[model samples]
Target chain A: EDKVVQSPLSLVVHEGDTVTLNCSYEVTNFRSLLWYKQEKKAPTFLFMLTSSGIEKKSGRLSSILDKKELFSILNITATQTGDSAVYLCARTPNNAGNMLTFGGGTRLMVKP
Target chain B: DAGVTQSPTHLIKTRGQQVTLRCSPISGHKSVSWYQQVLGQGPQFIFQYYEKEERGRGNFPDRFSARQFPNYSSELNVNALLLGDSALYLCASSPGTSNNEQFFGPGTRLTVL
Candidate 1:
């Protein structure tokens, strides 16, 4: 069975602190990886990475995938209270337009 | 364009009663998927429909069923509900089969008594 795992189930940091959330997956046929931020309801899209060594970034958030290691990492810079949310990592498998297997997620709390 | 949308922000039902949750995909999106999220846990896949056909299903029980309409809207039905069936049902829509980026709705919170 395919699976996704995330580390540091929860984190607390100062406003300017930088945080790194980790996600690793073991799937039959790898396709792509996606990141989402959830506050209280639906998850908003963040980034999608398919190739290794190449990083996809947006504003203060960035992510990269290491297919060789079957893992990915999301980095947030200059964090703010508004950035506090649950970060979810999911892996989509090849061969089908199917569901994404998500990690437990990293709950981030940023304080000013 | 409008994003994916779900109905009845919240609901309450007794055990053994049936429930129907609705979803409207983002305009121009041909695929719709449903997921169940329990508090403090990641969303669990339940069903995926594209172009009015079932594309995939999760490990949920037979009591859980869903279908997509010609307009690309969808509905999820849960029969013989139990206390364990209570959860937040999320709907997502994508433009095509290979599109991995799905837009999610606010979700419908279902409570089983």
Candidate 2:
């Protein structure tokens, strides 16, 4: 079975703080890793990492994947209260369809 | 462009009852996937439909089924619901079945009593 494990299930940080969320996976075939932020009902897309070492960034948020190490990390620099949400990491396998296996996710609470 | 959309934002059902959830993918999208998310847990893949064909299915039991229409809309049906079936059901859509980023719907919150 393909499994994804995320570290620090929950974290609390203040404004302007930097936080790193980790995700490690064990899969037979790896296609890509994706990150999402869930605030209320829906989860918004964040980043998709396919290659190792190269980091994908968007403003204060960035992520990197290490295929050799079978792990990925998402970093938020200078966090704000609005950034508080559940961060999800999912792994897609190399198959006919894009079936995602997701980690339990890290709940982030950014204080004002 | 409009994102993926799901119907019936909330629902309540008793055990042994049946429920059907509907979803409409984004315009021009040909692939749709269904997921179940319990509180405090990541969403679990339920099924994936591409071009109206069943491409992938998760470890869910036979009581759960889904189908994609020609218009790319889909419906998920669950029978003999148990209390454990209560969760948020999410629908996602992509351009194709390949490596594409899926956009999720608001999700349907189902509470089984």
Candidate 3:
């Protein structure tokens, strides 16, 4: 069975703190990894990582995939309360017809 | 362009009843997928349809079925619903079946009584 595990299921931090969320996966025919920020309804796309070592960044958020280690990490720098949401990591396997297997997700609460 | 849209934001049904959820993919998107999400858990894949054809399906039981229309809209039907069938049904759409990013709908919250 394909599995995606996320660490630190929940986190609480004050504004301006940096946080790192982890995601590890065991899947067959791995294709790509995706990150999403879910707040209230529907998950909004954040990043998609397909290669190792190369980091994808959007403003204060960044993510990198380590295929050798079968894991990925999402880093948020200078966080704000607006960053409070559940961060989800999902993996797409080849021949799966674009279906994604998602992790339990890390719930982030950034305080003001 | 409009994003993925789902109908009946909320629904309530009794056990043994049948329910249907609807979804409309974004304009120009040909692929639509269904997922079920329980509280505090990640969404689980249910079905994927593209170009009016069934492309992929998840581990869900035969009681859960779906079909795509010619216009790329889709409907998910669940028969003989059980108490455990209560969950948030999500619809996602992508441009193709490859590695494209999927856009998700707001989801329908189904409550079984």
Candidate 4:
């Protein structure tokens, strides 16, 4: 079975404090890794990483994949209260029809 | 353009009742998929429809079924509902085939008593 595991299931930090969320997966045919932010409704896409050692960034949020290690990490710098949400990491296995196998998600709470 | 849209933002029903959830894909999107998200867990794929055809289906019971309209809109119907069937039904849309990014809707929350 394809599995995606996320670490530090829940985290609490103050404003301006940086945080790192981890995601590890084991799949037969690895295609790409996607990151999403879920607030109260649907998840909003953040980035899609398909190559190792290459970093994808959007403002204060950045993520990188390490295919060699079968894991990925999402980093949030200078965090704010607005960053409070559940961060989800999903992997699309080869020939999986683009439907993703998702992790349980990391719930981050940024205190101001 | 508008993002994915789902109808009946919330619904409540009793066990053994049947429920239908609706979704409208984004303009120009041809693929639509459905997922069930129970509280405290990630969404699980239920079905994927493309061009009015069933492209893929997950490990769901026969009680769950869906169909896509000619306009790319879709509906999810669940029969003999159980407490475990109560969850947030999400619909997502993508431009073409199975290799592209997907845009998601706000989801329909169904509660079974």
Question: Could you say which candidate leads in TM-score?
Answer: 2
Task: List chain B TM-scores, each candidate.
Answer: 0.97, 0.99, 0.98, 0.98
Query: Which lDDT value does model 2 have at A43?
Result: 89
Q: Which whole-number lDDT from 0 to 100 does residue B69 have in model 3?
A: 94
Residue-level lDDT tens digits of model 4 in A1-112: 8899998899999999999999999988888999999999799999999999999999999999999999999999999999999998998767746777789999999998
What's the TM-score of candidate 3 when only chain A is evaluated? 0.98
Q: Model 2: which docking level applies?
A: high
**The 10-residue segment with the lowest total lDDT in model 2 chain A:** A93-102
Q: Which lDDT tens digits does candidate 2 get at residues A1-112?
A: 9999998999999999999999999989999999999999888999999999999999999999999999999999999999999999999999789978999999999999
lDDT over C-alpha atoms for residue A33 of model 3: 96
lDDT of 4 by residue, B6-71 (tens): 999999999999999999999999999898989988888899999998888888999999999999
Listed per model in order, the count of residue pairs whose N, CA or C atoms clash below 3 Å is 0, 0, 0, 0
Candidate 3 segments whose C-alpha is farther than 4 A from its true place: none
Q: What TM-score does prediction 2 earn?
A: 0.99
Which is the winner by TM-score between candidate 1 and candidate 4? Answer: 1
Error of 2 at B6 (Å): 0.4
Alpha-carbon error at A54 in model 1, in Å? 0.6
The local distance difference test score of model 3 is 0.95
Best by lDDT: 2
lDDT for A108 (candidate 2): 99
